[model samples]
Target: MTEPPRTVQSYIDQTPAWPDGTPTDFIPMTAMQWRIWLLAPAGKFFEGLVVFMTGVALPLIVKDFGLSPAEKGIVSAAPLAGIMVGALALGGLADIYGRHRMFVIEMVVFALFLTGLTWSPTYLWLVVYLFGVGLALGCDYPTAHLVISESIASKDRGKLVLSAFAFQAIGALVRTVVGFLILANLPRSGRGAGYMPPRSCRPSCWSWAGSRSATAGIG
Candidate 1:
């Protein structure tokens, strides 16, 4: 009888050794793997949070900073620029050193820079700190994926990696809900009362949002 046509997957399955000649072994899921999977997604969550929170905080930032259209544009684009730099620079470093080391280091840097957003003294400072946060976030993208993929078994790898990335959507949803709630509680005039000055409402809201966003990654 003629043999059936071999598919790509069949070829892969039939192969008993890696290209380097190491024996292929099935890796079992373990508690450590589960932790890495969850932690990797948390990085994506923070990335989404930082990206969306800027939109939520923009109007307030503009109002408080009295930013001209040009300045506003720079503020909005700063994080993206930082991401580009980090991806090009730090991503390569992760490849050379190791994924897990970069993963932990990047998250710590991300948390510190992200939390600093709340205390920015000026528009320039805010832009600088936001850029720093984005740099750390950019580093996370590759490192997190690499760590998760390497830690998990081949059979379940695709599902787990995609599942981890799903947290980005969750982060966006959370930012939207939180932004809505904060706006809902504010006065119709957009000014806060009590201890906070009418003009201080925007910064206060931004601070609260920044703190919450930082928490997601830090934990």
Candidate 2:
């Protein structure tokens, strides 16, 4: 007589070992792995936040700095340029040294440079600080990716990495909405109206978010 068809669970139960010769028992994500996974997305969020804030604050920056069109273009492109340099250079360093150390160091640098924006005395200074921010951010990309990929189980690796990138979109959206809300509430014509809003808000927001990314490295 023909035997009953085996169920999926029966097949799994019958399997003796993984390809690596380990037992085929189900393994769950560990606490440390989850922390690493969540931290990666926080880094991506700030990466997107800093990039979008440049555009959002551009008009105010132009007004404040009296930037020529050519100067404005350079200031806007500085972060992207720095990012390229950082990715090429620091990415290799992370691989050689270690991802966790690089991640913590880079996040601290990112926060420090972002905070420097609050006190920039000239357009050149602002550009320099922004470039530094980009450098740190560039280091973060590979380091964060490496940390998360190494920490998580193979089955969920791709999904978690993709989810981390999704936070970039979320960060962009938050910047837009916050900028709109701040603009809407300001008086149309007042002493400190347009001047303080973007200038004050951007640095504070950047510093706060950057610090959070830095602290996440400790977890």
Best model number under TM-score: 1
Stretches off by above 4 angstroms in model 1 are: 1-28, 190-197, 200-203
**Model 1: residue 144 alpha-carbon error in angstroms:** 0.7
Segments of candidate 2 deviating more than 4 angstroms: 1-26, 190-219
Q: For candidate 2, lDDT tens digit of each residue in 7-52?
A: 6435423435678898766656668778788776666787677777
Clashes of each: 0, 0
> What is the alpha-carbon RMSD of candidate 1 to the true structure?
7.7
TM-score of each: 0.80, 0.75
- The collision pairs in model 1 are none
Residues 53-105, candidate 1: write the lDDT tens digits: 88887876786678999998888888888788888788877887788788789
Of candidate 2, the 10-residue stretch with the lowest lDDT total is: 210-219
